[model samples]
Each structure stands twice: as structure tokens, then as C-alpha cells.
Target: MSQRKVTMQVIADTVGVSKYVVSKTLNNKLGVSEATRQKILFTAKQLGYSKDGPSEGPSLPLETEIENGYILVVLPNYEYQSISYTYWGAVFQGISLHIQSKKAGMIVITSEMDLSKKVDVPNLIGIITVGTVDEQTLLALSTYNLPIVTLDHEARIIRADSIFMDNLGGIERMTDHLIGLGHKQLLFVGNIHYSQSFYERWIGFRNSLEKADIPLTQGNQKILTIPYDDNMEANLQQHFEELRIHSTDFPTAFVCANDHIARRMIVLLEQNGLACPTDISVTGFDSLEEDKHLSPALTTVQVLKQVMGRRAVDRLVWRAKNRDYPSEKILIVGDITFNESIDAPKKR
Candidate 1:
């Protein structure tokens, strides 16, 4: 039979596979083994079948599947708008660049509508979750048994592929810097139990205090918490006001978890008639460029979010390629930015 006359049935018959398998392999629906996928594609090509009709065979975009299968970035309900939120945009940027380089298809799952409320993606290569998820979410995901890589989440119970910022080292260095500046009395801001990174940062803060012989006093840690709710500004103000009342005798400086907290600390402190680095010094993690807009500019830990994101993609693709490979975890460290927000404490 002429190569032009050969159909999917011919290729499936020759490869000893079903017609449906051959069709999915060609159209890229995803459940078949990679070896089987390759075999079907090879057979189909040899028999001269292409998406654009048989002729000289398939091109780069369509040798067998749709851009080498689908990789989904899930964030529960948050949409990726900009990298302004503690360097999340950088993470997205890194994922996009790497996936494009690999010539792969990528989709982000934020809500139920993306896949018609069905999380079942037969051809899913892997998943990279970018935000915090509850046990229910994790449980639902476990049912699929898809290759997963979690970013910025620190629930210790689940074992999966993950990448994390060096929260401990970064926060430790920031705390140590405050201590060195003659700021003996300092506070740790942000809720320590908010996420895994938050807890690690708290560990670093306590470690630094202990090393310096300073105590982690009862009221020194102010946990400013705001869940996924609409009244964040009001809640944040309330948290700060509650802290300010008890913070008078607390510290000369504050070690904030991330830039967002540091920025708020500065504003709230000013409202309470205190000035950063003058009355009280403050340092933060996640050296966001947008933070330059802050009056004194934030002194923070510089994070390589894009690098972390790229590393995650590397792990995800590798795991997908090697289905039986054990899960891997990657840790990325950061540097400190000694900006105007940190300085020697004011004289008593």
C-alpha cells in the first residue's frame, strides 16, 4: 500500500497496538507509556501519517503529541498577575521560559473552570503548585498521583517533590545584622506558623537570638496574620495596633519575614510615632525591587525566585521522563540587602 493511503489502522496493526492508542498518541491525549508513545509515533511516521496529512512526515511541534504533553502550574485560586508579590512573578517567568525552551505545553490551574472542574489530565506530565494548600487540596491531588512539585508550601506531612527558599539562613543573617547594629532588643514579625517558610524563618530568628544571648521574649514576636480574605488592610492595621501597645518596651529593631511585612511594619511604626532605623530598625526577606518605592526603602534578603522556579521545572521534567524516579527537593539560598531601613539604634 502507498504511504499516502496508509491510515492510523494500518500503523496500529503493524505496531500491534489498538487504533485508539495510535490515535491518542498521534493527537496527544496522554495515558500511554512513553515507550509505547515513541513506538506508535515511529510506526506512524514510517507509514507516513501526520497531523497535516502524510507527505514528508511530522515537524518539530507535532512529531507525536501536543508540545510534548501538558505541565500544569496550580495555585488553588490565585492568578499570576505580576512578580510583585514576594517574587512570585519571577517564579512564573522562570517556568514559562524553561517550558518554552523545552518546546513543551504549559497551563496554569487556578480555579475549577480551567479543565471543566475535572483535575484528571491523562497526558499530564507533572504539576507545580505555587501556593499554600489545605489537607483537602493535597488529598484531592494525591488521588491523581500525578508528579507534583510544591513551591512556598511547608506542610511537613506530605512527601513530594519541592523547592524552597533558604528561609533559615536568610532570616538568621538578617537577625544577626540587627544584633550587630547595637539593637539588642528586637522583634520577629509575621506569623511563624503561616507556612513552612515562615516556621523556618522563626527558627532562624530564635537561633540568632539564642546565639547572641538574647531571649526570645514572650511578646517580642508579633504574628500579623491575614488569610485569603477581603479585609486584609483592616486586619493588618488591627494586628499592628495590637502589637504596638505591647511593643513599647520590646525592641529597637524588627526582623520581618518578607518585604510585605517589613513595608507594613514601617508604615504602622510611623503611625505610632516611630521612625525606621531612627527610632526602630527593621530588616526583611525577599528583596523586592518594588520595595524601593517605600520611603526608607526596605533592607531585605534578595531572593532568586526565577532560579528557584527554573530548578523546579528541571526536577518536574526529569521526574516525568523517569516515572519511577524518587522525588527530589531543592533548596535555594538568598542574600541580604542592607538598605536604609536598617541602622544603629537611637541613643536612649
Candidate 2:
């Protein structure tokens, strides 16, 4: 059958208004009078005109079905070394499972790419962000007016919900454990970022030192502000060497920023003829499985990765459903898993 010829201009001419006004009124948009809206819609339907097809008129509701929309998942850096796949894997798995259960679609994007030039998709419901988000990216997300849920790092631009591991409490507990083992000279190795996790961990380390009456002088702490590049290891080694030289007393125990750094530091120490726990005790955060196989078995804090993942999905879903819900900041506490790497300080 030949298709019926129905155009928006024909409808506008019949309604005695411009095409723009007819388009707005037919779309049920604001700024048009109630009488005008009714008149435009009635005339368009009577003329067998439709936005989708003649058989399907523009009378379709503006509301989208929950299963029809897409959720954008933005990862800050696409580089392999910058992100922990294991952690992000669990988070994406949780989000994917929830999206599948709701019969929704997912669009994964990375901040490394220029997304502003890309075309925007309709029915974009919300965003699940993993890793750090800069101010520029946050601004882009805000323009969408969609709910946002961040994991790992919290951004100031987005007031949406955030879920992260309790870095302060976990580090404090780890420090206390070392103190209980009779370690007097303790050292904290950390990056010089002001990220929420980094700042919290630094605060926890300082608090633990103060509570134990241990002096937190410049000599005992090392802040390595090494840029993330191929020379990261060399830069860290230089800092390690400086700490070994300048400090009057070698720290009997060292609390490292994370498991990966701790493992590298352990290797560096051994190369310098220092045995872990025997000569110097070591501890790390994020109890990764690879650390377990280390000669001495690294002592570290076990972040509840799976639980954090599940909680993030729950919060996003809840916020998407209830717009009136208040923004939430959730910190999931982790456990201190003791291992052979940590022991009483060796007598000088």
C-alpha cells in the first residue's frame, strides 16, 4: 500500500501557527498554552500525521520504559596500569547484572576519549563512574541531569552518591596492629595525591601515631610524588634510597600505600640485603591474591570489593527510582589480615 503523505508543515499550516510552535505543541512541551496544545494535537491526529509513523501517532507518552534506556559507565583512564582490573571487574559485573535484570542497555565510555563531540543518545538514564573524575568530566556529566554513582574517588562537582572502602579506619587498624607488635619507629609510604582515599589514609596514619605518643617528625615519613610514567619504579627507588640514607634510624616497620607498592618495596629491600620482618617489617593495603604468594606473605587490609560493588549498584538503582532521596556517602570498612610479613621490631 502507498504510504499516506503527512508532514509537520501541513499540520502547522492547518493549526495557523509556525512549524516550530506546532512541533513544540505536538511534543507536549512547555511554553505552549493548553488550548494551543490541544488544538495542535487534535488537528495532527485528525490528519493522520505522526512523528514515528502514520500508523503510530505522536500521542505516545513522553515517559520511557525502564528496560528501554541506557546507562553509561565511565572509566577515568583507559590505561591498563592506571586501574586495577580485579576491582573494576567486580563493579562492572555488579552493574551489568543489575542492568540485565532490569532488561536495560549499557554504554561504556572512557574519559581518555573526547566524548563531547560524540552524539548523545536518547533515554540515557544514569551513569556509573569508576575511578577518578576531573572537574571537566564532572561538568559534562552534570549537563545530562542524570543520577551519578561513583566508586573509588569522590568528585566535588557531582553531589550524587559515592561508595568507597574505609581507607582511614582500615589504615588506622593496620597501624595499631604494628604498634601492638612493639614497633617503635614506623614509616608510612604514600603518594602525594589529595584524593579522598589518600587523604583519609594519611589522616589515619597520623592519628594512630599521635594516639601511641609516637613522634611524627619529617624524618619518619616519606611522601613520594612520583608521576605515573615508565620511570615510576626508578623514582620510587630514589626515594627509598634517600629514606635509607637521611633517616637517623631505619623504620622497623613500613606501612605502604597499597599491595602493589608494598610488593615492590619488599623486593627493593631484599635486593639491599634486608629480610622482611627479620630486619624490617612491612604491611600493605588491598590484600590482593598475588601478595599472598610472596615469600613472607604480605600483611594487608582486605577491602570488601564484592560488597562495595553490590552496594554501589543498590544505591544507583535506589536513587534512580526515588529522586527525593538524599545524597549518600558510604564507607565500607575492611578487615586487617595479619600475615608473616609483620613482626616485632628487631633489636638494633
User: How well does each candidate superpose onto the true structure, as a TM-score?
Assistant: 0.70, 0.74
Candidate 2: segments with Cα more than 4 A from true spot = 1-68, 79-84, 117-119, 219-229, 245-248
Clashes by residue pair, model 2: none
- How many clashing residue pairs appear in each of the predictions shown? 1, 0
**lDDT (CA) for every model shown?**
0.74, 0.76
lDDT of 1 by residue, 1-348 (tens): 655566888888898999999889888897999999888877675566755667664422222232577787876565552555557777888887887888887877663333424565667777787867666666566556666788877545555787898899889888887888787877777666667888899889888889998865565543344542355456666766665534556468878777877787788778777788788888888877777876797888888878877888888766665444345667798888778988898777
Candidate 1: minimum summed lDDT over ten consecutive residues — where?
57-66
**35-79 per-residue lDDT for model 2 (tens digits):** 787788777866778665675433432444568788888876554
Deviating ranges (above 4 Å) for candidate 1: 1-67, 81-86, 111-122, 155-158, 217-250, 322-325
TM-score computed on alpha carbons, candidate 2? 0.74
Please give the lDDT score at residue 186 for candidate 1: 75
